[model samples]
Target: MTDTVADVTPEIAPSSYDAAQRRSDAIWQKIESDPSGLRMLTGDRPTGALHIGHYFGSLRNRVRLQQAGVETWVIVADYQVITDREILGDIQGSVRELLTDYLAVGIDPERATIFTHSAVPALNQLMLPFLSLVTQPELERNPTVKAELAAAGKSAMGGLMLTYPVHQAADILFCHGNLVPVGKDQLPHIEQTRVIARRFNERYAGGEEYFPEPDALLSESPTILGLDGENKMSKSLGNTVMLRMDEAETLKKIKKAKTDADRQITYDPEDRPEVANLLTIAAQSTGRTPEDIAEEIGDRGAGTLKIFTAEALNAHLAPLRARRAELEQDPGYLMQVLRTGNERANAEADETLQRVREFMGMVY
Candidate 1:
C-alpha cells in the first residue's frame, strides 16, 4: 500500500489532471489493493464544541489510526445538523470549530482530509439513489433512528432522521471507505452500510464489487459518561468537559462533578455509577484499570479521587490545549488546512461518483 500520495509533475503528467487528482487516484488504488490499509470515514454533527466524550470515544482512535498510516477522512456532518434545524444558525461556525478540534487533537491535515458535508455535494446527492436500495422496515429497525426519536420525545420522526443510516451509508460508500471508527451503538449503522454496499453492487454492477464493505474500528476506551454521570456526555446537555478547556476550567468541572457520597471509592459501575465513572476516566487518562486506580488511591475520598483525576486529565490535555491555542491564533492557516483537505476529499469522491454513474448506466 502506498503511504504517500504520488508525486505529479505537470510537464510529464497527464495534461487533464493536477497534482491533487493524481494523488487521489493513487490513494484510491492503494485502498483497493491493500488488506491492512484502512480508508476511514467518520464524523460528528457540527452542533458545538467537541467534548471529552468525542475525544475518548472517537478522536483518540482516529489519531492512532492516522499515525499508523491509515488514509483517514474526517467529515464534519454539517448537513445532518438540519435534522433538528434549530441549530442552523451556527452550522458554519460549528464546522470551523470542528476542524479546529480535529487539528488540536493531532489529526494531521497532511495525513488526513478533514472536510465539511456542505463541501461535498456529489457525495450528498448519492444519498437519493442509495436510499432506494434499503427498505422502510430496515430503516425503522435501526437503533440509532429509534434512539434519536426517543431523545426528541416524538412519536413521529422526520424522513431524514428515520433514514439517517442510509445517509451514513452514503457517507462511507461515497468515499469508498473500508473502515469506520465507531462506538458499539453505531454498529448498526456500519451493518446498514455493508448491506447497502452489497445491494448497490448486486443491483447496478453484477459479478464484481463496486463498493467496499466497511468494517467497524471499535474504540477501546470506556464509554465516556457526562459530568452529570447519568447519560452519555453531550454538549447540548451542558454536561460535557470541552476538549479545549483550560486546566483551571477542567479542574473546576471535575472538582464540582457529582460522585457517590460513600466514603470509600470502588469500581462498581452498576451500584456506584458516579464514583465508577470517575474511576473510568482516571483509568482511561492513565492507561490503567479502574480497579487498579481505585486500589492505588485506596480509602481516598471522592475529593482526592477528583483531584487525582483532574491532574491526570490536565496532564494529558495540556499539550492539546497548547496546540489548539497556537492553531486558533491563525485562522487563515486553519482555513487553508481545511480547504486543502476538502479539495482532496472532493477529488476522491468525484472519482467514485463517476464509477457509480457508469455502473448504473448514467454515463453520458
Candidate 2:
C-alpha cells in the first residue's frame, strides 16, 4: 500500500498486457486441481513484530500454501533489514520472537522451511554470477527499492539497497522457487527474478533449461494501510495493529484511529482513507464485504464502526495471540522448529548452488 507506483507512460503495449493476463489467469486456474502444488518463497524482514497487515497480506497465504502441500520457504530477511538501519539493534531477539508468531499463525514447520538469510551461506555464493547477469540501471530502476528508500527519507542509496533486487534474485533462484506469493507491490520483484532466471539458464545451460522462471502469484488481499491512513501498516511507523496486542490495547488503538466528521460509514478509499481502512479491517476479519458492513451500520456513526472493527480484529487475533504466547514460553521448542527449518533450507540451497557450479564448469 505504501509503494510508490511509477508512471506507465512508456510501457504502452496492449499485447504485452494481454499476454501477461493470460499467463496470470492460467496460474490461478488450476490452483485447486493441481495436487503437486508450487515451490513458494516468501517472508518478512525481522525489523519488528508483525501486525494484522502481515497476517492478512502474507502469513495467511503462507499457511494456505503449506496446507496445500507446497514446498514453502519462509525467510527471516535479516540481511535486507541491515540495508536501511545503521545499527543491527536487537535482530536476534526480533527473529526469535517473530518465528514464534510465524508458527502460531499456522505455518507448520514440518511443511514450510524457515531460515534466516545469513544462515544460508549457499545463497550468498550465487550473488557474484547473478550480479553479473543484471545491469546497474536495472537495479536502480526497481520501483520497490525506490519507494523504500524515499519512504525512509534516505537521500543516498546504500550498495545493499541498490542491489537488493539482485539479492532477492539470489534468494529465489537458490531455492529453485517457481511461485512467489506476494502483494501487488512486490510483483516487480518477481518479474526481476524471472529475468535473472532466464539469463542464467541461457548463459550456462548450453541449450537446456536449468531454472524455472518464477511467476508472481498475487494474493487477493485487500491493501491494509496504517491507522494513520497515510502509509502502509508498519511497526516502525507506530501505526500497526500488532499481532500480539491484547484486547484492550487493540481496541484503544482502533478507537483513536483517524476517521472523518461525516459520521456516516462509507467505504470511500480516495477521500476517506481512514474510514475505508477501518471498514477493510472489519470486513476482512468478519468474513463480510465492506459494503455489507457499512450498510448494516447504517449511519450509526464512526464510533459504532470503530467498535465493530476493533471487536472483529480482536476476535480474529485472540487465538493467534494466545498461541504465540504459549510458543514464546517454550523457547526450546520454538528454537527446534527454526533449527529444523534452517537445515532443510540449507540443504535445498546447497543443492542448487552445486548444480550452478557444475554447470559453470567450477566442479573440478
Best by TM-score: 2
Best-fitting candidate, scored by lDDT: 2
lDDT score, candidate 2, position 107: 86
How does each model score on lDDT? 0.77, 0.80
Listed in order, each prediction's TM-score against the native is 0.88, 0.93
RMSD of each: 10.8, 3.0
- Model 1 lDDT tens row, 1-364: 1000111111212332243244444554554466265788877887767888778877887887787678788888877877744447777677778888889999988888888778888888889779889999988877666776766677878887887788788888887898776555566677788889998889987947889887766555678788878887766677788998999999999998898777788899999888898888888888888999898788879999999999999998889999999988899998898789789878888988888888889999
- The runs of at least 3 residues in candidate 1 whose Cα sits more than 4 Å from the true structure, single-residue gaps closed, are 1-35
* TM-score, cand. 1: 0.88
Clash counts for all predictions: 0, 0
**Residue-wise C-alpha lDDT for candidate 2, range 1-364, written one tens digit per residue:** 1112221112214564455556656777766668374688887777667788878877887787677777788888888777777888899898987898898899888777889888889998888889988998998887777877776688999898888878888888788888777655666676788888899989987857788888777677787888998787867678988898899999999999988898788888999999999999998899999989998997899999999999999998888988988998999998888788789889988998899999899997
